[model samples]
Target: MAERTSFSNEEYADILFYYGAARGNAEQARREYGEIFPNRRLPDARVFSRTFRRMRERGTVVRYQGDAGRPRLEVGDDEEEILNHFQIDPTLSTRMIARRMGRSQWKVWYTLHENDLHPYHYTPVQAIEEGDPFRRMQFCRFLLNADVEDRNYLKRILWTDESKFDKDGITNYHNAHYWSVRVMGNPHLKRQKGSQRRFNLNVWMGIIHNRLIGPHFLPQNLNGVEYESFLRNVFHELMEDMPLETRQNMIFMHDGCPAHFRLAVRSWLDQHFPDRWIGRGGPIPWPARSPDITPMDFFVWGRMKSLVYATDVPVPNIEDLRNRIINAAQEIQSELTDSRVVKTGVVRRARACNRNNGGHFENEL
Candidate 1:
């Protein structure tokens, strides 16, 4: 007897009926089939059993057509439905939308891409208060006016800020990874914990006209008194290397932190820098929560941290971390001296801020 590869719907129904009538016995069903269709060749006994089992399991002996060929890319209603899901909730992930709509994730993703949709990562920005925009606009205009007076005004201002560095340096897991053929254990980063006591160093740095001054270490908990002493003693000494004329003409800038706004600190700025300083209650009021405009905040610290923590090895101790920070600062200083990129960015940011009416402008830049 010949083995059959295909069966019509009527032929399938007859095979299932005969198998059922024979009390689920494949040999009896085959015999019955041969008797009923005397002219037709008998299908293999295994075919009868398989047909019977398929009917019992799926309520039909129809072969599955799902994997017959590659599925055509869906258009019309499917495309409209996928687009509608995104239009309703733009925050929905492709996987989530796929599950909700009973579609494959790749299909949904392809549809989005076909429509020129892209996923944009969210950027964290400082909160702007009710009166912040007005103040920001005012301050940005002040910078612009100063620039008009001197083309090199932005470069002549010393940008300063303090940042903390510790054994557990920043690690962007998104960009850090190891590729392999097989699944492996997650890589661990060692860090100091409680009882072992993690150590942190508060570092202050200044950038002015392609020159970087002191990677000065401040007390862990900086207060008004410590900040005042830093200005009175440490800051002036750091300026010794600058040309006398440049030092006289330079403008000092710091943020509106409580330590920076102290009476003694403001008084020192008034005496030393006179009207050539920008900060809280100084000659120029640096807007609160406005790190977006400062070169130290917007550029230097981020760049230095990336360089300091570029290695996979964890910093062994406070001393090691300090050395890494000093080295990173030196590298940044060399880059600064070679180009006017950072200084030029200050003027560009000032214009952008003014155009935005003092709102967040980093995104626009």
Candidate 2:
């Protein structure tokens, strides 16, 4: 069993005063509280400072104020409504209420959690609209169901997701800090409308471990037949290009889009590379709406969007978008070259298997 660390409420109070909400990080918090010190000393500014900074960044504390460049969070009007609503009734969401009240969704989420009133997020929020989460989860299940030692040796697992990249695309991920005047103005008015949402780079990205194989943008006006053709072409290209050991064992994962699932496409996959081609509906079992578990979900698109969309680059047309996406992908590939994600598909699937007893994610995939 894991050894648990324990402390009394008084010790906890000392911790909060010295290290947390009491502004006691480093030099100040320790001295003022004067609690038992394991090392009988104050923590250096860097250690406590970084931990506290991460706390602030992760929204553990409402706002870090009084210091230089620190943001001051002003309490908003609708907080009581959130505490009352989510607390009293279970089904309502910060987003739902905000939509009804015509407020920024962030403001609602912030107010609830900041006040220590937020209920746990019961499910993983869907990042992709119209995406089947369980289906994506099932694909992950299939990948992990393979011989782990062999798959790990060959790095043979891959998954794909689509994105539209625009030269002027802005896909930055931001912390939702309500009460920061810098982010949102007075309660009387709303933030300016039409901050960038979508981008012009429409790409189909293929991800495997630390490697990014493609940001393959579909040819203009691609449909089901075209997509199926691209699959055949890409698989041939991918398999042949691989080292000898890897080419024989690779599993190509994709969602159940009409292009992927159409009978015509199925026939082609069944005819040519019968056993090599693995898809959502493979024998292993899969779930829809499971991007929350896929490598592409965890590693690629969100990251790329954060890089490409977060910028103020100029992309007025598809050509400009394509150029920017190309440049950005190259830059990201280079920057993330030394970075390889350790996959958790096996661990996660094992837990899911426990939950299922005998069933599997790929049962429907």
- Residue ranges of candidate 2 with Cα displaced over 4 Å: 1-124, 127-154, 167-199, 219-222, 233-241, 283-285, 335-365
Write model 1 residue lDDT over 1-365, tens digit each, in one string: 22223677777778888978987666688899999998776775556766766677767666453433675455447877987776676556777878988888999877765444555433456777788888888998888898898888888899999888887787353422221111112223222222112349998999887898889999998899999999888888988999999899899999998999899899989998989999999989988778878888778888998998998788898888999999998899888867786667777888898888888777666
Candidate 2 — worst ten consecutive residues by lDDT sum?
Answer: 180-189
Candidate 1's error at 16, in angstroms? 50
User: Could you estimate the TM-score for every candidate?
Assistant: 0.65, 0.52
1-365: candidate 2 lDDT, tens digit per residue: 22222344444445555766544435456555455576544433333444445455764422343444545344355766655665565446667778987888877766654543324222213333344444444454455555464647325666676655556544232422222111112222122223123544457877665566776778555567888888778756744555665545555566655567778776775665456555555433345544445566556766676765565756566765666567767776676565646255444643564455423332212
Whole-model Cα lDDT of every candidate shown, in order: 0.77, 0.53
Worst lDDT run of 10 residues, candidate 1, spans: 178-187
Sequence-dependent TM-score of model 2: 0.52
Candidate 1 wrong stretches, greater than 4 Å: 1-117, 171-199
